[model samples]
Target: MQIASPLINELQCGERLNHAIEHGRRGEFALLLAMLSQDARDMAQFTLGEEGTVDAKLRRQFELPPAQTLVADVADDSLVNNGGEFHELGLRGFALQQALKPEALVTRGPISVTMLDALNNTDPLCKSRYLEPQHPALPEIPHFNDRLSGQLALAQRMAQA
Candidate 1:
């Protein structure tokens, strides 16, 4: 089965949270929160083992948002759009950063390959459960190199694997 990358999982989690808020579904909200928290922990661990510290540069590269703020914002109904929805779960900035950031190790091709590897190697079953099909607000997973040519490299790696 094709598995989603961590970045995709994070984006999906954010989308689900927004969907729950829009619909006032407490159960969905709880579920999304758990997924997000778990993913964050996984990303943090992966980052630490792969890199080392959460340096300002690395944080900036990862575009790790202030988790507290992101959660609080999602919890606030007032911040939700008229449809009680927030597109992209207000995570476009972070997503872009993550997609574009260079890997710790230098490479001849795109840097996203490392991130894609990190994401693909991550447990897909755990990531996919939270990405329920009913949640329509999820961000479209971009083509590997829509913005960054690095995605192409990542795609190649995935294909090979």
Candidate 2:
């Protein structure tokens, strides 16, 4: 099965932000962290991996408001950890950034012109789960599943009429 890409937009970010705040208020760390931006997600994962760090850093970030000064001060650094240690970039900061400016996360680097061609050429309906073809091909008659065979035969007769 093909995996659909995650939808991220201003409206979606705003909804997620509100949901995350509710989760934080309820002290649901896992649920709150799940709504974090990619960068914050990575930081949370790394922080959780380190022994004796969650209670002191990441959990506190989850409890605070996104607009708080502590949350707003987190710097967006490279994904890599150079010195074999994880730094706290504040998950609240990431959430605030996402809420205030979702376009930054949506913006991708320069892509090949062929990308647009592929998108334009693709049939959007072909990917739909509920799509029904107007002229469906009849299956082999008198095959397995007697009910389906009878239905196909009736359809074939109807088409000829």
Candidate 3:
């Protein structure tokens, strides 16, 4: 699954924090100390999984109950406003945002192909360091070289007109 950059960064940060806690390295501990205030760490535990022995115990101590496991209940109107209405435009925009899973997009019915095409036409920003540009079909999308050439040609034509 393609994770977003922010999520990837958070995972990396979490791993670093875990490492720091495990090794008890003063420098890493100090860095985390400086970067995260107590309130920030509380928020992190709520959002990202809680890390660090002390932090986890502190979370329990503070009665900052573990975050709910189930997805939050969202209203249908909110879903529609958020582009979940299953229309072509909504699906296209949703695909652009990388919000819809491939299966979910496909199962939504007739607009699936168009949505998939639009998704194919777009490129996801590389998120994780482990991710490689290895998808075989990725090369078919208009690369920067072609896009630049098209823009220049359009500019030249406009200039003449």
Candidate 4:
């Protein structure tokens, strides 16, 4: 997790700015990815025992747009939190991601690097009756959590056409 290292540095104030930018130069989804990247940077500010503080930092990031990158770093920590059904979910997601686009587009700019989406997708609550019946996720147990529910209800109401 190279990201873990720089994240530590950013937190410690090695540079004036405490984060690296995941440059999302494309449209909306890319910007969302960029914001998530900035969120990752914001997350780095918490000290070791302050792990619990990440949620509030993320909440604040979700409230704003991504800033332009002064510099960027690529970190591959995809396997950091692997376990249980998550293992199966990771395999499936890796397969799907590969199948969708085996090669990333240089011209398309930064694509969103969603970490552990498979975990949310496989959540038992999401598989339960919480999601709307009409949701496309009804048939897919593993892809159900991203649909409208308590955590996503706000997103649902604010969804764009």
Candidate 5:
């Protein structure tokens, strides 16, 4: 009988999580939650940060009960230095290693809570924090209106030309 390394098992768990998010598999997410080690689960929940508040607010507005367990609440800024946005795109391996380092989690705070939240509720069709700006539950910022007007003006100019 062969023994699997803990690191290898964790990596596989992370991969399963990634697949669940990418494919929007709520059932798979549930299974992953069940199978994930407590440490990994804690890391996932810790990463939700501000996103957890956002999720709670939205849930209350919709009359949904407050979430008890982790809900894939992705962190705004943890792995990436890019202004509170997720930057690790298409990272192939080391999902658990990259995601759940205790030192990193403690130092940098929750890095991927949004994905944790996604596992619970795959609705709204935009699970990743990177797409959070488009989530309907989140109100549009005032600057977004100014930016939109500028974009429309630019588009009009191009059309006239």
Candidate 6:
């Protein structure tokens, strides 16, 4: 769908991917992952050259709003009449596409053992892989304490000035 460079990653290949989990229905996120064809996934990585993750793309493609803070164990009603909450967000199409058929692919609890394994691995397309980035390490900043001290000193100087 005209995916730009750097192809959405949250460590599924970036921190931006968490919005999907925070906003999506319990276990429903997996269905979204399945919807993305393998070729689409591969093409994304091929274009980015760094194993693309799909979260950000989905958000932008579907015109999703930013997610609010939500409980981890919230129960999903999966009912349209209850409040039309998902419909209000324009996700009815998403529900129709991913929920109506292929019943086994969508779920509400913790993913199956195999699914978890797939996500934990380096599969760029695995939604879980994006949840936790591989080889996660903080980058070093030179000067250690000097940078903070220097900034503080500069602030003090500006205050005096």
Candidate 6 ranges beyond 4 A from true positions: 1-74, 79-110, 128-161
lDDT of 2 at 19: 72
| Candidate 5 backbone clash number | 17
TM-score of 1: 0.21
For model 6, the local distance difference test gives 0.48
lDDT (10s digit) by residue, model 5, range 33-101: 665445443354355555566668789789975343232324533332222223444343345434443
Q: All candidates' TM-scores?
A: 0.21, 0.16, 0.20, 0.14, 0.19, 0.19
Best by lDDT: 5
Ranking by TM-score: 1, 3, 6, 5, 2, 4
lDDT of 6 by residue, 64-149 (tens): 76443222212445422322545565677556644443223333433344555555554443453344463232223446588889
Q: What does candidate 1's lDDT look like per residue over 57-117, in tens digits?
A: 5777989753322222233343322221224444665455444442222213222445545
Q: Each model's C-alpha lDDT? A: 0.49, 0.42, 0.49, 0.40, 0.49, 0.48
Clashes in each model (backbone N, CA, C under 3 Å)?
0, 0, 0, 0, 17, 4
Query: Considering TM-score, which of the candidate structures 2 and 6 is the better prediction for this target?
Result: 6
| lDDT, candidate 3, 47-155, per-residue tens | 5444647667788789875542232223222222334544655766666644433212222222234444665554443211112443223324466899999999999
Query: Which runs of model 3 end up more than 4 angstroms from their true locations?
Result: 1-12, 37-42, 45-161
Q: Whose lDDT is higher: candidate 5's or candidate 6's?
A: 5
Q: What are the per-residue Cα lDDT tens digits for candidate 4 across 1-161?
A: 12322222233443233222324334643433433323333464543464446656776768843332332223432222223333567777756654543423222212222423443455433333243343323332334566436557877767853
Global lDDT of model 2 = 0.42
Worst 10 residues of 3 by lDDT: 102-111
How far off is model 6, as Cα RMSD? 21.6
Q: Which runs of model 4 end up more than 4 angstroms from their true locations?
A: 1-24, 28-42, 47-161
User: Worst ten-residue run, lDDT, model 4?
Assistant: 104-113
Q: Model 4: number of clashes?
A: 0
